[model samples]
Target: MTASANLWTHTNTEAVDARPLDADASADLVIIGGGFTGCAAALEAARSGASVVLLEAQSVAHGGSGRNVGLVNAGLWLPPEEVVAIMGEAAGPLLIEALGRGPETVFALIRDHGIACEAVQNGTLHLAHAPSGFRDLEERYRQGNRFGAPLQLLDRAETARRTGSERFHGALLDPRAGTVQPRAYCTGLARAAAGLGAAIHEQSPVTRVARSNGAWQVEANGHRVRARRLLVATNAYHAGAEGAYRPQYVAVSYCQFATAPLTAAQRAMVLPGGEGCWDTALVMSSIRTDAAGRLIVGGMGNSEGAAGAIHAGWARRKLKALYPALADLPFEHHWRGRIAMTRDHIPKVVEFAPEAYAVFGYSGRGICPGTVLGTAAARALLGAGAEALPLPVLPAYAERFTTLLGGYYEFGAALSHAAAPRLPV
Candidate 1:
């Protein structure tokens, strides 16, 4: 499998391999997918001294991992109170409390492994797109504060000052959140796992995986590998496989465009808080600066190729509206990738057999949640129970023909965006 390029085509990292599969191999575990989740699980399992084999249909970070918003945010898509209400007081609070520690886990790994990705730990701002959104932020703030989160709600002027954009009513700032160079980060995990003795194979498209004689026989590229446990980490890029767990999902895509690094004079006026920021618009958009000061602005992406031109045009206008000072600046890179979303905006894990499970769906929030959950899942498998895992394992949210939903979400986002004026600074 060859590596695919996306908005993360930065000069800082180059993909390491595109090799073939292992022939007649057996291991304690076989993980499918090469994105953040797969890499994290591989790293965790290998570090634990297990015999591990990670098979990627494509190169590492070849999916959403390479095309993410790069925000290492804390918590989940659901609010603290809402999570408590849904997962019930006991299980829900337990889940949120663990996820609340996500940023620290991510940052500590970055430091301990000495990964060279551009890791920024200052903070992140969640801006309210409307006054009503401010009320939502208020509730979230109270709930998060009660849970020991270091979050602050800022007024309109403070939000403008923090984001360097005056288009929001207010915002919730999470001090624990930060940003990173996503591809570099994913590759770092893979390298670390390999260093710890994991047998990671690229271009290994698993064509068949079946439970045979109480063990998993996984075939790929004319080779067969057997394992006691199997992990499926193919989320948004899952190629349909027979016997694979069907995931219920609506495809949501996000696109991004990056300007060349800002001049010293230009850098002074953008993201002065040195924090990543995204607004709570119906069709959300994120804005942030790279370590080199290149500003990336992203929003919903379209599956239709024709919509590319429209989104590209909209991005130009949105950039102008967000920062009138850089309205005339040239954009250097542009790309888009899909996000797997369930109706409830929660990820699901399904056990396909006695010892095999497939973990999928993260709606677009990939980095922290992906690693935190994926690593925990690997440990749970190794430990033979879900009790030690950080999240509540959701086993039965299944749907078919998920990839088709990509077009539907794109159409909806395109129509909604068509009716709105460009972002107003």
Candidate 2:
């Protein structure tokens, strides 16, 4: 398979046909990046009667948005109290409450727009990889119940029945979460926004952004877009835009391998509830079946690097260990994407300038938080105050030793993947 080959891209039927910006244009808002955040913001702003122009470095959803695990989960990776501790007393619960409703926003958009992405709202599973992992889930269950989340703690037998695997010690099921064809979802958002009069330009990489004559001028594809407000939603795939604020976060790579569509019998024996799943290992891993019944296994390492073969080999072993019946099945699709992780594992909305913001650092939880933050950022840019947004807006946020930290994560993932086969499940 090619480097860019992804199961989502091949399976997606909803295509957003947009041209590159070929002429200077003016709008109320000009957005850089065309991932979920940018597309969601465009749709929201255009629906609110604002003139919006979205410029993409490549195609829509070409970044991490396209290469995600497709799990539309609620809230961040951190537990409720940890989030509250990191964000503060008032702001923490507010953000938590807002994100708790993120899946609703995402699913509503899919339903309202008639998006063709295979959106399954059957909920997601957080599997416990060991006895210690089960303890973590116990705490999470407690916290989730305190916050009124409809979460259930499943015993090992129930988890094995649902997942068709006896490797997990327990599982936490969150009914509010689900999955989607992430890339197709982003394309659908772009198409919906364009239908609402938003101008979305693909392959229009922004080279420079500056404030001039009381407007934000974004230069892209040899043309200029002058707008009253600007939003940088690039996340980890941000290239460079002069005078535009670049997000500072640790960039960790996540890679996935997908098998061919399983037979009906195979599908029936595996993930019968159609819920996406991830385990609570130190180096976490994920498993989910697509709408086409392809079993996708993902891990925390770059699949395009020297350790690619090792990770791929580990994935094969992992599949066999989890489901011995499918050991001979081969992966037909392989791809990798980067995640922008903040120190606190929380999403942020950075107020870079007046009427301008950069939202990113969803960690590995992009679908829900991206949609919520993107929509909130658009509302704020169009005159809604900070109170209207989900997360607290900061004047500036920075991370020190980002490259070192990113390297550390990569090294750890490589080591773990290499050592996985030696360790018994």
Clashes of each: 1, 0
lDDT of 1: 0.80
The candidate that achieves the highest lDDT relative to the unseen native structure: 2
Give candidate 1 regions above 4 Å deviation: 1-5, 12-18, 400-405, 422-425
lDDT (Cα, tens digit) per residue for candidate 2, span 291-367: 88999999999989878888888889899999999998988999999999999999889998988999999999999
Worst 10-residue stretch by lDDT in candidate 1?
1-10
How would you encode candidate 1's per-residue C-alpha lDDT over 1-425 as one tens digit per residue?
Answer: 01123557554473444367857889888888888888899989998999888888878888889888899988887788877776777887777877789889888888877777789998998889888889989998998999889899999999887777787899999999999989888888888888888888998888887888988888888898899998889888887565555555777888888887888877877877678888777788889999888888888976236677677777788888878888888887777787888765666677767777778778777888789878988898887478867556655667666557767778867876665573332
- What candidate 2 gets wrong by more than 4 Å, as runs, is 1-4
RMSD of each: 2.6, 0.9
TM-score of 2: 0.99
Error of 2 at 173 (Å): 0.2
